[model samples]
Target: MSSPPEQHSGQGKTSDRASSGKMAPNATNAVSFFNSTAFDTRVNALINEWHVPGLSLTLVHQQELHSKAFGFATLEPPRNCTPDTLFDIASASKSTTAGAVALLVDDEENYPHVQWDTTMSKLLPDDFVMAGDSYTNNVTVEDVLSHRSGLPSHDDFYFSKRSSHPDDPRTVTRNLRNLPISVPIRTKEQYNNSLYTVASYLVEKLSNKSFEEFLHERIWKPLGMSSTNLQPDKTREVGLGDRMSKPYIWKEESRRFQVLEYEQTPEAQGAGSVWTSSKDYALWVKAIMNKEAPINDEIYKGLTRPRIFSNPEDDDLDPFCSWQGYAAGLESYFYRGHQIIQHDGLISGFSSVHFFFPEFKVGGVFLGNSENAGTVGSGILVKEIIDEILEIPESDRTDWNARQHKQNDEYEESKKESQEKLRKELSANDDGLAEPLKLPLDVYVGEYWNIGYKEMVVQIKDERLYIDASDRTMAFALDLEHISNNTYFLGTIYDMLADGEEVDKIKVEFRFDANNRPVRMGIDQEASLDGQLILYDRVEESSGQGQQKVVVR
Candidate 1:
């Protein structure tokens, strides 16, 4: 992995600033430090050592923004990642969504009187019903943003859902009450994307605009984030689509990065789906650093003010971050006695981190196109950059790189072992029943309904039994491989999960009536945190002639 030529966004202006010799003292120091050969060596070494395809980074100190790009956007084509190469920023999109909601709350005309403590019951529609204690109904907007709404990170509901399914934010909010609460409301903090979708919906309801539209109007367009957007379709439309970094995951067997198909979920946009480049993201950081106008001061303060302790027990254990707490959408922590605000974003193949120290007026954003890049690479680079900015003494660059390589090596080894075990188990049990098909394949093809989830339609498409859980928010057309008896394996989803990935696997077991006609479908979905098998009853017609046929014994 040779070091690719770095591209700067505003080189002409930056040169002028440098020549003018009028830069703020802190800005001058930051520019010298980040551009120093030592910083470049560490960053390039990390990229090469981790097999990262591409990475885009931006640094801001004392209001001066510096953008840099490294490696290939596509390994095969060998397109270098530029300052404007877009990468999905994942969970870093949270702050923008939260900021959108805050902006709406700040609007006098729309929200005459609405605060973070405002009850969900009052803000949301009458139909929304949260399970658990009476306290569940009293959850506030701030509580949702801070991950204290008694909900765990039920990420699968978003990650594994059908792409064709209606990803309306309102629908996400409606399903919240159906899931069990992880803890008593306001008692503990649990980070999840579901509530962010709910909060984004709140923004939509108040502003009478889509979350993306609100951000574009208030933040993106205003801040000059020309290459930043919530939708890939829009990115393509602007001709920046081709510049987007191809996502990749490290394959243990191959000992190389394997490219993954570009996947976009607008449904989870609120939680983690924003595409941006280093150059574009710098403008966002500039907005935070400047806190210029109407949107800045109020929204920035809300986004950074600590609302709940995220890791109270580990405050002393981790030397990297201390006094950890969850703010609106950002994590507020002290790094080496400097108040740092940050968030990390990890989707399928891309990982991103956006961190800033308000007190020091320094910030950095990193985007990488590899799975390992998101898991550990970004953190490593951040530490290196921070050390330089803080001027730490006798920086052990060699030791740092060595430890990072060891960590990644261990991860790959563990992943390989996990995949091998899953493969063997799946193969061994694939024919466990050794029984013939009990009924016609058509008997199992019908629309099954689950109240907790929704409709799962099993249909024969192109002469193959396919389950379309589009209504359940799963975009994949699950091909059912007949394993044994009435059991079927969802091959497509299962394959990805076998690789130690996050794809949800559904093992479908068709329950039959006395005459061997299917009456109910029992699906073991990976999304269920408690490992409960969800049962969906086959829908019967009014004429008494339907997929569910009653046969009395």
Candidate 2:
């Protein structure tokens, strides 16, 4: 691997004060720390170890923004990643959605009916209905934005190709009624992207503009974030495709990074679709930190105010963070006596994190085009910077790189053990018979339909059964490896799209009627909802073609 080259903005001059254990709270001091050889070595080491193709870092100190870029953005043509390179911010877009809603709430003269407490049903009565009657009637903008709406993240219902649902915000919001509510209202903070989509839909209803337009007019334009947009294709349209960082995933078996196709999620506009460059995102973070225009005091407070525990159980385990809570769109973490308001975004092959210290008026943004960027790489760099700023003794500073390596090793080991256990279970036959499947493979091949997750087609090819989506994108297909009787292991194909290591090998079970005919297929798409299976009933043939066995070979 080639060494990552550095590109600095040169906004702040390097100071010799960085050599001390702690630097004074100033932009120059912060720049000095960032420019120091020690910091550069640590960052390069982390990037090389994590196999990150490209990384963009932006720092905020004393209201000044400093940014730098490292590594190759595109490997095939050998293009260097610059600070202007655009990357998908993923779930980090949630904060912007919340900010847009806050802008609407501030417009009391025009949108008097729109408030944080205003029920979603009142905003979009025709489309924003929940599963439960009470939830449908009472859920508020705050409830959905804070993720306390009692809905588990039914992400697969929308992201999975099996669902031929329309890629519009209103339609997605309307489909929420068909999903199951896994918890009671306001009891737990379950992160549901669907609710964020509903929030985006609410933005559309109130502003009388598309979510993208609202963001551009209110937030992006005002903040001078010209590079920020809601779609990747927009980058290509504007003749900046070469500046867009290609997404990549680390393949453990091959010990190399593999590129992946851009995950186009027009439906997840508010949840995770914002794409921008480090240069543009720095202005955004700086605005939030300095209470700049468009992000007024009320908006900032609404965006950062802690409403519920994000993960109360894990509070005691972290050495740096004492408490953590989920705010409207952002997250609050009390790290080492400073309140850090932040959020992290992760999608297929992109990860990003933006965080700031309210007390110190310091913040940082890390955007990388690889899976480990936000999960492991960003955390290490952020903590290291925080330690330097806070004047923590070098001996007391935790070895985040080592800590992350150990944790990652343990996680990979556990994943391997689980996969082995699943393999053994799938191979075992209860009756000890050579024929594991109770019915012929042809009998199980048919079209299954569900209201929330449209149609799934099972077919036979090369004498083996396979399941695929009707509106398949990226050519998604899974093999039906027979486990025993009616159950089969959904084996995903090892392709460029699938990282292989994290592929969800969910089980599929076929339900047969009294006459021993397959009637329904049960799949645990929403595994977070207590393992409840989303049943897809068989789609019977039309009357004209009735009683004809369909086979695809």
lDDT (Cα, tens digit) per residue for candidate 1, span 391-445: 7775534345656666668767876665444334344364333344455668777
Per-residue error for 336 in candidate 2, Å, reads: 1.8
Write down the lDDT of every candidate, Cα atoms only.
Answer: 0.68, 0.75
Best by lDDT: 2
Model 1 misplacement above 4 A: 1-29, 132-136, 158-165, 313-317, 375-377, 395-449, 455-553
Shift in Å, residue 508, candidate 2? 1.8
lDDT tens digits, residue span 24-98, model 2:
354344566877766666666677778787788777775566677677677666677777889999888898988
Each candidate's TM vs. the true structure?
0.78, 0.89
Model 2: ten consecutive residues of lowest lDDT: 10-19
**What is the lDDT, from 0 to 100, of the residue 186 in candidate 1?**
70
